[model samples]
Target: MFDFAIVGGGIVGLSTGMAIYNRFPNAKVVVIEKEETVAEHQTGHNSGVIHSGIYYKPGSFKACFSRQGSQSMKEFCQKYDIDHEICGKVIVATKQEEIPLLENLYKRGLENRLDIQRIGSVELKEIEPHVKGLGAIRVPQAGIVNYRQVSEKFASIIEEHGGEIRLNTKVEKIHEESTGVTIEITRGTIKAGLVINCAGLHSDRVAYAAGYKTDMKILPFRGEYYKLKPEKRYLVKHLIYPVPNPKFPFLGVHFTRMISGEVDAGPNAVLSFKREGYRKTDFSAKDLAEALTYSGLWKMAGKFAKEGFDEYIRSFSMKQFTKSLQELILEIKEDDLIPAPAGVRAQAIRNDGNMVDDFHIIMGKRTIHVCNAPSPAATASIEIGKEIVNRIPKQMNLKESKESVQIIK
Candidate 1:
């Protein structure tokens, strides 16, 4: 029997495993991933912007964790000799009417204690010459990195510390007992004294298997992106985002200069028929049936019918998608956008058509389930792992925090 069993091989799971193994070196820890590699889901595919906690409400988990996570992620990268850049981002206001919203965002940035500066059109032009905007907020703390590399580093640390990472292991059921928990996988059964569910895309289903009733349902929203051709990449110097519509869940289509020296735009959020569905038409019968039958989906459809329709239109029409990009930068033509990979956000929608804004975690006597972790999750993975480790009881302390499982140098 292992001391800890973690489900999911994404950044969150890997970081959580690292944190746990750091605290308990002697404990037999195992991380199980349904896929052959780690971060094959949302963690692997995202805008890859290390968020500065500017958009989140102050005092919320998103705000606290993201702020700390950014620092931790940067520190971890430096220690591990990983590739990253602390290139700042700007939130722009292209229209005159968008000025106040830009100001509000700057004020929110201040409230969040971010190193931010409000710049006029002149400074904005200096930062991004080709981009047109009336005003902008320069978030100096924002940065970029390849989270997949970070996940791999965490996996290596876990293995070096004597933890097992079992890939192609899908847990079908979880049974909890007075002593611990029993996980039934496709290969066989594994019993653990404690189980932490960090299953990203299938977290809610895993929680259900563990017998926790959540009012929120996991709604998959595919954020489709388009990469700017190498020649057109110079159009965006830094990440350029718009003021998010508080009524909706996603931050509007934006530009991100990735660590790999490529610029990608968009990631318009739309409902996905399958949990891990990335393609426009890829659908699972059960995943589709669950979403269509969910009352929350219907409620959301009734409320945001216009936005929903627009998203669906963009999903199937390249012309419409290109038009949306034109709002941020007019230079992007239909042909400039080649096929880009997609990430499905496991958004937790409530019964009242509300999208969960904060990170949601549930605790049992011997289990903890991460139900929702959306944007900035990759940036916030380290701090989220630390926070989760703090919540675990003292008896589970199989290793000391100060113990170097491996040489840091």
Candidate 2:
């Protein structure tokens, strides 16, 4: 029997496994992933923007972890010789009405202790020549990195410390007893003293299978993107974002200068028929049925009917999508764009129809389920892993192992 078993080999799971070895070198630990490799989903498909923790509310998990995670992530990258850049971003107020919202965001950034600055149109022009905005907030700490590379490094560290990474191993069910927990997988069964449910999109289902009754349901929202053509990429010097609508949970269409030197634009959030649906045609009947039957989905739909419809429209109409991009960078044109792979966000919604704005984690008898972790999740992944390790119950016997730990200091 292993001392610990972690489900889902995403960035969070791999980082948790690394953290566990840091604390307990000789402990028998295993990471189980359904896919053939780690970071195959959200972690791999993200825009690779290392968030500066400006958008989150102060004192929330997102705020705390992201603030600390940014530093830790950069340090980790530097130590490992990974390719990354601290390219700052600007949240622009393109319209006069968005100025107040922009100011509010600046105050929120200050509350989060971020070193951000408010700039007028002239200053914004100096930074991004082609971008047009009345005002903007320049977040100098924002950066970008390939999280899949970071997660792979985490996996290597776990293995170096004698931890097992079981790829292509799917957890079918989880059963908890007085002594330990039993996990039934595709290949066979495994017993562990504790289990961590970092299953991302399937976290809620995993929690329910483990007998935890949560009032929230995981709803998948797909964010589609378009990459700027090589010749037209010069228009975007740094990340450019719009002031998010307070009523909406998404960050709206934005421009990002990825670590690979290509600029990506326009990721409009829309309801996905499948949890992992990346393409418009991708569909799963069961996924659609579950979403349609959920009371929360209907309630949320009713509340944001107009915004939802607009997102759907933008998803289908390239011209509409280009217009949103034009709001930030007027030089952008339909001919400058090319379709890029999309990502599905596993957003959690309550029975009351409200989206979980912060990161949500719940504890079970012998399991810890990470129910909601989306954007900035990759940015805050290392710190998040430490947070999970810190939350492990003392009864689980967290004493340090006798073997010497090999984790890089």
TM-score of each: 0.96, 0.98
True lDDT of residue 27, candidate 2: 81
TM-score of 1: 0.96
The global Cα lDDT (0 to 1) of model 1 is 0.87
Clashes found in each candidate (C-alpha, N, C closer than 3 A): 4, 0
Task: Report clash pairs, candidate 2.
Answer: none
RMSD vs true structure, all candidates = 1.8, 1.5
Which parts of model 1 have CA positions greater than 4 angstroms off?
A: 395-399, 402-409
Clashing pairs in 1: 23-399, 24-398, 24-399, 25-399
Instruction: State model 2's lDDT.
Output: 0.91
lDDT of 1 by residue, 306-393 (tens): 8888888888888998887777778889888887888899999888877788999999878899999877889999888878877886
